[model samples]
Structures are given as C-alpha cells and as structure tokens.
Target: MIQRFKASLAITLAIILSFTAVFAGPKDTYASTVAVEAKSAILVDAETGKVLFEKEADLTLPPASMTKMMTEYLVLEAIDEGKISWDTTTQISQYAFDISANPEYSGVGLKLNKDYTVRELYEAMAVNSDNATTIALAELLAGTEGEFVKMMNEKAKEMGLPDYEFVNSSGLNNSHLDGNHPEGTEPDATNLLSARSAALLAYHLINDYPESLEFSGQTTAEIDGQKVTNWNWMIPNMPGSLSQFGYEGVDGLKTGYTDLAGNCFTGTAERSGQRFIAVVMKADSRPSRFRQTAKLFDYGFQQFQRKELFEEGYQIDGESELPVTKGKEDVVELETNDSLSTLVKKGDEENYTIKYNISKDKLDANGKLVAPVEKGQKVGTAELVYSGEDQYDNILSKKTNTVDLVTTSSVEKANWFMLMIGGIGEFFSDIFSGAVDMVKSWF
Candidate 1:
C-alpha cells in the first residue's frame, strides 16, 4: 500500500508540472528570445503614451549622447517660440571649436572660423549625432553650456523626469575638471538618463517639435557642400524609413553610447496615423540596440490598436427634450469637448461599446435647460463595455470617459427668466378668459 501511494504522488507531480509548463512557455519565450542585454529598456505607444513593455526602465544610468535629446528639445522649443529661426546663423565659438577639435569627443569637424545657419547645425547635430554641434547650439541659445544644462535640468523636472540630471549640454564628463572651470581636466562630462526618462524626453520632443523629424529622419545630408549621413542605422535598414517612420508625424530625437552605456538609443517613429517611441539603454552592442527597438516597434504595431471613444461635436444621447427658458430656441444639444480615442487590443474592436447618462433633474418643466448649460458641458458620463475576458476588467470598468453635451446659445439665464415670466403671463391670460366666458353665460 505504501508503494502504491508513492506511485500516485509521482503521477500528481507530473500533471502539475505539465500545467506549469503550459503557462510558463510564453513567459520563458520572452525572456530567452530577447538577446539584447540592457540595464533598462522600455517601449511605449506614442499616441496614447502607454508603456507596452518595460525592464528596469526607471533605473538611471549614463545616457551618453542621448542627452542630446534634451538639447534638441530646447532648440526646437526656441524655434517654435520664434527665439531662433531656421535661417538664423550661429558662429563657431571658441568652445564649439575646442569640442570639435578634441579627438575624444564626437563632432562634425566644423571649421573653427566658419559660420553655419541654425538649420545646418540642427541637421548636423541630429543626423550625424555631432556632440560639438549640439554644444554650440546650446551655447548660442543660452549664452553658456552651464546655463543651458541648468535649463535642461529644469525642463526635465517640468516634464516630470525626476531621475534625469544634466551636468553639461554636450553630455561630457566634468567631474575630473575643477568644478568652476569646464575647460581642461578631460572635461569629464557625462549625460545621465534612464530608459523611462529617455523615452519621456523623446516623447516630449516629438510632441513639441513635430518638425524635428524633417532633420533627424534624413538618411543623408549636404551641409556646406559636404555630405553627411544619419548615424541612426535603423533609419536606413528599417522597412519603412521615409514613408513610415519619417519624423513629419515623427520628430528628430537622439541616440547615445559609451563603453559603460553600451550603445543606447532613444528613437521615435510616426506614421501620420500612428506614433511610437522606443528606448533601450546599455544594450549589449550597436546591433542589439536596433534589434531591440525593432522588436518594440513590432510589438507596438501588432498587439495594440487605437479606437475612437467619441468624436467632438458628437451627440451622445437625448432623453426627453430639454426645456429652454427664454430663448429663440427652447432646447440645447450636448456634445463632447474633444474627440476621445484609446489604444485597445487588436481583436477587441467589436467588443467595446459606450453608454451615456445625463442628470434629468437639471432640466426645466418644458424639457429645456434652466439656462446654465454651456457648450461641451460635462452633463453626462460614458462607460465603455467590452465583451471578452478582460485582463483589467475590474479596474478599467470603474473608469468611464465623460462626454460633453453642448447647450444652445439661446438658452441663457436671462432668457430662461424671461421664459418663466412669459409662462406666468400665459397662465394669467387663461384665468381671465375663463372668468369672462362664465360671466357671459350668466347674462
């Protein structure tokens, strides 16, 4: 009997192992198949700004040249604000010349005595990944790289990237040098960023400088009659470089590397209809950075889809007609202030539905409003229902998108008061008519 009990236990163990194997297969596949070795990595949807995948994404590390993304962000902001124009010319300052001449730094090899337009510098900085051009642009914008670094840090904080810290606009080491002096002492400048922060910076640039892609997305350039090609390998090799990933809907961002950072990349890709940002830091090597990013893009485009929740000016629902007080029109229409859209799983389109509810007590006896309804007013709430099993059904079901119901302009408070007075007048008129008819019948 003891031997039989042992055999039964063995069979039960085998069954449990089989079940675990079935469930663990997909998890193991993801772990084993991803070859890139990075301390941190993240893939996010550009449209919805949703994180699709993450691995130690928040751990801060040396960002190398990826710090240039913030530099680029400020440059574009300047352009947008008209502080600088594309044709604006910037001279090569002594500092800019020094960075370019320094063999230890990445530079565009700009002639010390020459001047380049803001457009040229932007292209070189973005496309060739020129550290020197980036520094020069910063100095030109803020008068000094130190001040610019301060601006960069401030911008990071404003954007809520708390883990990011900028010591130099060029992202060079500075600790080896005297704290007050940036010159000499190997400049010891290093840029700091995390996978999550890098992605966020890219997101902000793409959002703020939609025009940045016109430069970063270029695979090649001819500045000052010399040809330069973009260092972002994925732009050339990706299947839809210009047609699909071009920064028009996309924007020019930056990539980074160091022996310690190990080939980091923060990239943005946008088709007019869709946009996505992918960040991989400390990737095992140059090739792996692109590979990991491609994986991110594939997962983003394949697994998720965007659904329109509601369109602006869309009529949500109408119960009984709302009363209008004292206006040319006696009713108001409710609508959403803005169109609503959400990223959903690819196959879940038909399963989603929207339900709207409005407060009935807010209306007058005539079914009109009491004259306080505004256009795109939040008069109703909408719930999105899905049919299939939900991974986050309980959490998601509790949240609903609100729809705006617009009120007619004629439905004003004054008009409503006048309407009430008119109603009273009509009531008195009916009473007087009945009394006169009674008196005539008696005669």
Candidate 2:
C-alpha cells in the first residue's frame, strides 16, 4: 500500500507539469525569436526605431545594389542643400558610358557626351537599380566615385550604423567594375552592411526624404524612351508578376542581388496607421527575400500594436508634484506633457513603469525648480522602463521610449517679506536640530 501511494503522487506531479507547459500561451513559442529565412534579418518600428525582431542582425555581408541607398541619400542631400537641382545636368564619363553599354550590367543606355538631368539619373538608379547612373550621380556630386565613397562612410558614422563598409557608389563586386573600380578601393572589395545597419539606413532614408519613394514605389518608368522596371515585386498594384507576391502597404525601398550576397531586400509597409521596416539579407532565392519579409510583417501586425501606455497629463505615483524653490507654492503639480505611446506586444501593456529623469539644467543648486516657472514648461523627460523579460533596444543611437515632463501651473517668486520669514524659520530649525544632537551626545 505504501509503494502504490508513492507511485500515485509521482504521476500527479508529472501530469501537473505537462499541463503547465501546454497552457503557457502562444507567446512562449516565439518570445525571443521569429521564423525568418535569411542569413541576417531584422524588423523595426519606423516611428519609434524600436527593434521588434532580429536574427544574426550584426553579421556583415555584401549589400549588392542596395548600396545605391547611400548614393541616393547623398544626391537628395545635395539637392536639399541648394548645391544641385533636378534640372541640373552632367555628361556621362567614359567609365559610366561603357558600363551602361554593357549588357551584363543593369542600366539604361547612355549616349556618350550627352547631358542627363539629375532627375533622369536619379529615377533610373532608384527605380531600375542602374549601376552606371548611380556612378554618374556620385561623380556629379563628389567629382569622383571614390570621393563619394568617403562621404558615404562619414554619413554612416554620423547615423551611428553599428557595422558597415562602403567601397563604391554601386554595390557591384570590384571585379565587375570592368577594371575601373573606384580610385581608392581594391579590385576585390564590395559594399557591406549588417542587417541592423541596413535597416537603420532605410529608417533614415524614409524619414529624411520621403520623396524618394515617389520613384522607388514605381512599378515601371520610362527613361530616355527605354523602359525600366522596379525589381521589388512586393509593391502592391504592380503589373504582371505583381499578383504572385504583391503585399499591401509595401512601397519605396531597395533590393539587391549578386553571387556572393544572394538576395536582399529592405522593405517597408504601413497598415492601420503603423509602419514597419524589415531587412532580409542573403536569402536563398529571389522570392525567398520577399516571403521572409512577409513573415516579419505578419508577426509585427498580428502580435504587436501601438499602445498608449500613459495618457496625456497622466501623473506618475509618488511623482505627482515637484518641490519649488523660493516660489509662492511649496510644490508644483507635474504630469506628462504628451501621451506616451509605443509598439508593444498585445496584452502585455501592464508591464511597464515610469522612471523620472529630471534634468539638472532646470533645477537650482538645492535640487528644486527656480521661481517664475511657467505653466507647461518642460522640466525633463519621463522614460518608460519595461519590467518584462523580453527587451530590445531601438536601432537608433538614442532611446525613444520617453516623453517630456512639464509643470501643471505657473509659480511666481515669493515676496521679500515672505522670503525673510522663511529664512528665519529655516535658520532656527537648523539650530534646534543641532542642539538636539549635542544633548544626545552628552548623554
């Protein structure tokens, strides 16, 4: 009877453990990873720069034609800085002309010694992934493709890309440059960027020059009477093969391919007022990149949402007011200056706390705000501190999970008589406290 009783207890414990594992929720299956078919991949919220998912995101690999993203950024910057305009024209060099004339490379035919406007070349490079046109724009802006490569590296550093190397304006292997690779780069060198770096670059591009999408989103465009088609088949409403892989809200990004890089795509999509950027590098096939991107979008859209964790003017517990210095009021009511919203896993909204980050510049030596404070004046920021097991940093160099902290009402400086009275009270209070300490010591 004793042996039978012990066996029964063991069976009961095993059954309970099995049930617990079965009902732990679907999130348990993918809390730390998602199914992505690629060498390196990442998904990020466009507005917040918060990473939603990543897999081998820091592994450096060839970027292929995606290198033109930097070239495109530089051209747009030049145009915005008043150094060039869409109408500005430059004749192609021998190198550009030769590359354009080659059937092996992607290009629209360029006539030697003929002028091409910035608009024409930009459209060709953006929509068609034209290698020669990319070089032409680089030369036009930097006087040489080699110098433009320098600018690309500098800008990448400024943007805080975690890992990247830009050897040429176009992403072609140096051997493909027909023995005319950029002046400073080696013949074997090629452009390289990690999945995280590519996503970050795309984030900056989409946010900085949204106008570029006007071309990248195009299914097809005519340049000098030659038809050019966008290689990205994910664009909705695309012609012919669009029905096979068209994804809604996908528009305006870049694609890359080479023997070494395999297939890569930096894709962005929006739905129900939310936008996400996804990058897939070294995918096995041309279609695999788009399919992998679709999986990332499905995970993001189905499992997460932009939740308003804190409403506007919501006051934090124990931090509802701030001490005032030399003001009519001893304390000033405080609240969030604006709503704090961010992308979070659905149903996990209660797992965050507010961390007050009061700015020193707004305070006096006494760790209190000075008098004459205006209503709604920003004092510092309130950061949202997550208390969950799954936490990911934003792709940006700075954190985005914070909102401004502001004063609820204005406070005026106290009158001279009131100041004098307070000073007298504090001086006496200090003396009394010291006397009490002295008495205790003597005892």
Candidate 3:
C-alpha cells in the first residue's frame, strides 16, 4: 500500500536504490504509555494511522456525543459534494421538535416549522451537541434519520471501521431521554463505536473535511439568536473546561457522555509539526477524559519527533544511481515527486532498513527496473522499516513511512541490440551485488 505520508527526512540512503525503500524498524506498541481511565482508548498518529498506544481499542462501547462526529461528517460531505449548500434551508420537522421539547435534550431549541440553514444546524449539532439539529440535518439529507443512520453505517464499513452501529444521527439512546420517543423512531436506538473506530472516524473528519475544525474547535458559536458552547472542553473557555491543561494545541474533535457510556473524548492536537489523535472512551468524569487525553498527547509530542523519510519532488542526490532497462537512457535518475514522512524517536535513525514494497519480478535478474519508465512515473515505493537488531522495535523507537520513487527522466524502449546488452549487464551486476553483500557480511 503506497499510503502517502508527511514526516521528517533525515536518514541518508546507504545502499543502491531499489523498488524497496524502508526507513526504520516495524513499530508495534509504544513504551512508557500513560494509563487512561476510559473503558477503551487509543492514541494514533493522524497522518500514518500508527497506533502509538491503545487499550481495548476494539472493545465496542456506546459513543454518545462522539457519534455526532459522524452526523456532522455526512452534513459536511453533502456541502462539499454540492448536494447541499451551507445556506440550504431545512425545516425543523415535527419529530425533531418533539425530541427537543419532550425529552428536553441539549439543542439550540429547534422549534417545529422553523427553517434553519444547513450551516446553522451543523453548528448546533457539532458545537452544541444539539440532538434536534442533527436529526433535522439527517432527515433533510437522507429523507429520514433512520436512512441516514444506514448511510453512516455504510460509511463506517467503507472506512474499515472495526465495528460501528449508529443508532441515531443525534447519538442519543432511548435511556438518555426522560420523555416519549418520536412516533416513528425506536426508543432503544443508540450508537456504538470502539476507540479504534472513533479515532478512525475522527481521522476521516479532520483530514477529509478540515473545515469542520472551524466548527468543532470553536469555544462558542451563535445560531438562531441563541448562544451555544462547543461541548468539547479541550477548547478554551468552554464551561468548566480543561483548556488550562497544558495542551493549547488541542484544536478540534468530539466529546460524549451517556448513562451507558461514561465521559468520552476523542481529542486531537498539533505541536511541533506533529498531529496526534487520542480517544478515551467511558472515563469516570469529563475532566478526567481531557486529562487522560492530555497525558496521551504529552507522550506523543514529547517522545516522538517528526522525520521526513523521503521528500516529495525532491531529486535523488546520488549520481551513481541504478540502471533502467528498455529505456532510451542506459540509466535514469530517480527521485520522488511525492513526499513521505513519519514520527520517530529523537535519535533512532542510525540503522534503519529500506523495505521495498515493489514487485521485484518486474525487474530483470540483474535487479534493474524494466524500461518504459516515464518521468514522474511511479515504478515503486520505498518504506522505512528497521534493520539489524532494530527490527524488533516498536512505535517509540521506529517510525514507518513510505514515499513514491519516480523516474527523474523518462526511459523509452531501447533497440533489440541494446536490450541484449542490458540483459548481459544485469546478469553480471546481480552477481557483483551478491558478492558485495557477501564481502560486507565478512566485515
């Protein structure tokens, strides 16, 4: 998988360039992990999806308001796809009005027959955790909230979420409300999302629809003449907020709480060019959720440093590069038009391996890439893994990143005579390569 990533690149190429390029050792569980009180928790590298730390990540649990992240995601997706404009007006259906008034749930007080723009409802749903507004948005987009939940579930499947079941667009279970359920809706409905899935959903939201942070991260907003505060306490100035906690980098994400699920927060922060997502589900208290998240971010930011493994559009500096067959040139300069980066500990790049994900069968026995290599054409990618004793490393010690290596100059099919000459050269080169490895082993 040629997953495009951005990190720091400080490791120098040590051997001949190949289809396989590795950075450091394979990473597993990171060390010195901070214990979180949540029932399920995961801290991941936002760019690389590396699970730096996790506890019962796949154990499914009620997501509560964190489920609203999905609700707002579909809304933003519609706005981006031009299906609905921010100004697109939607009516507050009788069902939405019932949920707001009868249950007296959190909302901007959406009333029956009142028309609110998509932007207003979205802000209410995301920032204020307004249940009525989210249901309204869901019904407007999918004809009914139930249908919209189906879409949400489908999206979760598409995103490879380990497990997710969205009960309502509002993330409200029947138990949370004291009043009657809307006529057609099931009172027992509730969303279930594991920490891994929550972090994954947050990843899609922050990366795909960055504009969402504008709403989720805000300390407060106003809709329909009502002042609303973003429930995410990580944001500064929120009610009884933990913004005083050291991490000002905590920008945007979601928070949730319910009778079934304790206080849960899926948090993200960027410091020193590194962005990390930490999800703590079912914590005993709201403040502790942020506190645990803060500890996770501290572990990530302090222990990990961003490294650029391969720079995008950066030319390979080596003059004696590898040969390419069936091309006009006997050899071609290789460089990456796309960059890749990873997060590694401060000083662990000393002996990393280049794990080439390339299909070596495409190369001649001499290990030369076959011809028709076009400029900017991706022949293969180089992944940074580990070598020597470092192969058994984990997240804190190794950072895995991959970058596409393309031809700096295009290579066309050579004449038949040249092909024979290249084949012979490859044969000898392979032997020499093996011999060189044998000699190096002796040393």
Candidate 4:
C-alpha cells in the first residue's frame, strides 16, 4: 500500500508541473531570448513611446555626443519659430576656431572671420558631430554658449526628461573646453542623460522634425570641400568602411562616445510598417552598441505586434452600469470613450485585464452619480492592467494605458414631486423594517 501511495504522489507532481509549464511559457519566451550587453539600455515603440524592454534605463551617465541631439532640436526649433533661418549666417568666434583646429577632436576647420550659413554649420554639427560648429550655432542663437546651456536645461525640463544635465551645447567634457564651461554648470561637468531619457529625446526629435533624418541618414556629406562620414556605422548602405554593421531600415538618430561615457547610441529603425527606438549606454565598444541594438530590434519586430485590446464604447461585464441618485433612471450605463490599443507579445493578449476606476467626485456620498449627468461626460477612467510576468510601462510619466469612461446617455433629474414621493416611501419602509428587527430581537 505504501509503494502504491508513492506512485500516486509522483503522478500528481507531474500533473502540477505540466500546468505550470503551460501557463508560464509566454512570459519567458521573448525576454530570455534577447540580452543587451550594456550598462543601461531601453527599447520603445516610436509612435506610442511604449517601452518594450529596459535594463537599468534610469541610471544616469555622460552621453557624450548624444547631447548634440538636444542642440539639434533647439536649432531646428529656432528656424521653425522664425528666430533664425537656414540661410542666416554667423561667423566663428576665436573660441570656436580653437576647438575646431584640435586634431584630437571630431571637427571641421572653421575660418574665424568667415561667415557660415546655418545650413552649413548644422550639417557639420549633425553629420560629423563637429564640436565647434555646435558652439558656433549655440552662440549665434543665444548670444553665448553659456546662455545656450541655460536654454538647453530649460528645454530639457519642459520636455519632462527625467535624468539629464547640460553643461555645454557641444556635449564635450567641460574640462576639454579649457576653462570656458557654461556659467551655470560645474567647470568639469559633462552632459549626462539616462538611457531612457536619451530614447525620449530621440522620440521627440524625429517626430517633431522628421526632416532631421535627411541629414542623419546621410552616410556622407561635404563641408568646405571636405567629406565627413557619419559615426553611426549601422546606418544603411554605409560608405567605404564598417558596412557589415549596417542595419536595414535604419535612418537618422545619433551616436556618442567619451572616455567617461563609453560607446552610446540612440537608434531608430522601421520594418514591417512598425518603427522602434532603442538606446544603449556605456557599451563595451562602438560595434557592441549596434549589436546590442540589433538584438533589441529583432526581438521587438519578431515577438511583438500592436493589438487593440478593447474597442470604443466597450463596457465591463458587471461594471457596465453605475448607480445614479435622484435620477429618472436608477443607473447609468458607462462605456469607454476611446479605443485602447498597445504593443503586446504575439499571442499574449489574454494576459491583459481592464480595471475600472470611477471618480469619487462624480458620485455623491452614497457612491452613486447625481442626476443631470450628460451623455459623453467623463465620469472616470478605465486603465489597462497587464497580468503577465514581464510587465512594462510607457516611457511617459503620464497615463498612457488609460481611457476615459463616459455615460452612454444623459440622466435627467427626477421631478421634485417624484423625489418627495420616493422619500416618503423610503421613510415608511425603513420604519417597518425597524419594527420587524425589534420584534425578532424579543422572540
């Protein structure tokens, strides 16, 4: 009998293990398949800013030349706002000329007394990551790099970048500037950004100024009869060197490196009608950043697809109707104001659930909405809740997975006479119930 009992226990254990394996399969599938070898990394959908995967993405570190993306943004913004134009011209300062002449740095020679158009300087700054050209543009726009650094900081705050600091427009270690660091920052400070923050900046950059891609995507460009190649080796159809690292569908973005920051890249690629943005910080080498990014892109494109989880006007099962106080109707029907969609691992839609959050202010002390509610009035919100083992939120700090909950039809207030009659009936009914309870206690 004891031997038979052991056999039964073994069979039961096998059954339990099989159930666990079946349920846990999807969550473990894609995440374990891809790994990024970087100090910090993030992958997000370009259109929705939905984060797919992240590893220590909030850890802040020097971004090196990636900081130029912000400078590029402000330059384009200035042109768009009529403060500057593509044809607007500025001359190089002695300071800019000194930086440009350094062979150790990435630069194109700038003639100090020669005027350069915004288009020329911008191309150099964006394509070659030219430090002097960046400083020249900043000085032109803000009167000094010091004032431009202030604008950079203010703009970073406005865009809700969570972890960032700007010490110079050129993204050089301030120490490299030879005692000319921006006034508001530390003398030795370097521009810093988290991997997530870098990705967010790239998201805003391409979405706002898509034309920036025309410059960033170029494998080669010329300024002053000298051709400069983009440092991003992963750019499609790269010229002459490192073409093996070229990734298809890749276009404009940015790359950076420093003794302090290591190799970093914010890359964007579109394939199969979907676009993804990825960032890697403190990578081991130039090629490693691109390799790590390719792994993320492969996982994103292969394993995930955008799915509409709930349709517009979708109503919850038991929560479809909310009670209404002093209304012609006893309850009001509630439905989602907009459709909800999100990127999910393929075949994992069942892992998502809806949570309805009714606004307390919209209801009275009795937990019921008061009468005179109008159709389509927002009463609360329905938030998407992921029940999967691997869960992630959008890069945005604000609500991204939530939609407004609204009433399906108007609820008119009951007439005074009807309210009075109902109150009288309730008063008598309560008295009768109290008498019955009192009698039951005596029995």
**Candidate 4 residue-wise lDDT, 68-145, digit = tens:** 999999999999999999999999998999999996668788887898999999999888899999999999999999
- Give lDDT: candidate 2, residue 162: 84
lDDT on C-alpha atoms for all candidate structures: 0.67, 0.86, 0.72, 0.86
On residues 1-443, what C-alpha lDDT tens digit does candidate 1 reach at each position?
A: 01223323433644565466556533234444344366567777764466666655655677888888888889989988999998998788776776776656666678877778888888888887777788789888998777787788889888877466677775655652235323221255455676777887877777777777777777777666778767676674433443343223334457777665678888777664777788888788777777777777776677777778566655545542355665555676555456667777667777766555666666566545665556545555554555644332111113444554444343445655676888899999999999999999999
lDDT of 3: 0.72
User: Per-residue alpha-carbon lDDT of model 3 for 1-443, expressed as tens digits?
Assistant: 00111001101211211112233223223323466666667888887777777766656677888998888888889888999999999798777887777544785667777778998888888787888888888889998776887788788877777667665777778555444333344576456777888998998899899898888877888987889877677775555534564357877788888786779999998876678999998888977888888888888888777776655665545532568757787787766656656666557766554544545765799889778776776666766664433223122224456677666777788888988987899899999999999999998
Considering only N, C-alpha and C atoms within 3 Å, which residue pairs clash in candidate 2? none
Q: Which stretches of candidate 2 lie over 4 Å from their true place?
A: 1-33
Q: Each model's TM-score?
A: 0.68, 0.90, 0.75, 0.87
Clashes of each: 23, 0, 23, 0
TM-score of 1: 0.68
- lDDT per residue for candidate 2 within 202-320, as digits (tens), equals 99998999998888989888888988889888998778855588999888699999897889999999898899999999899989999999999998999899888888898977777
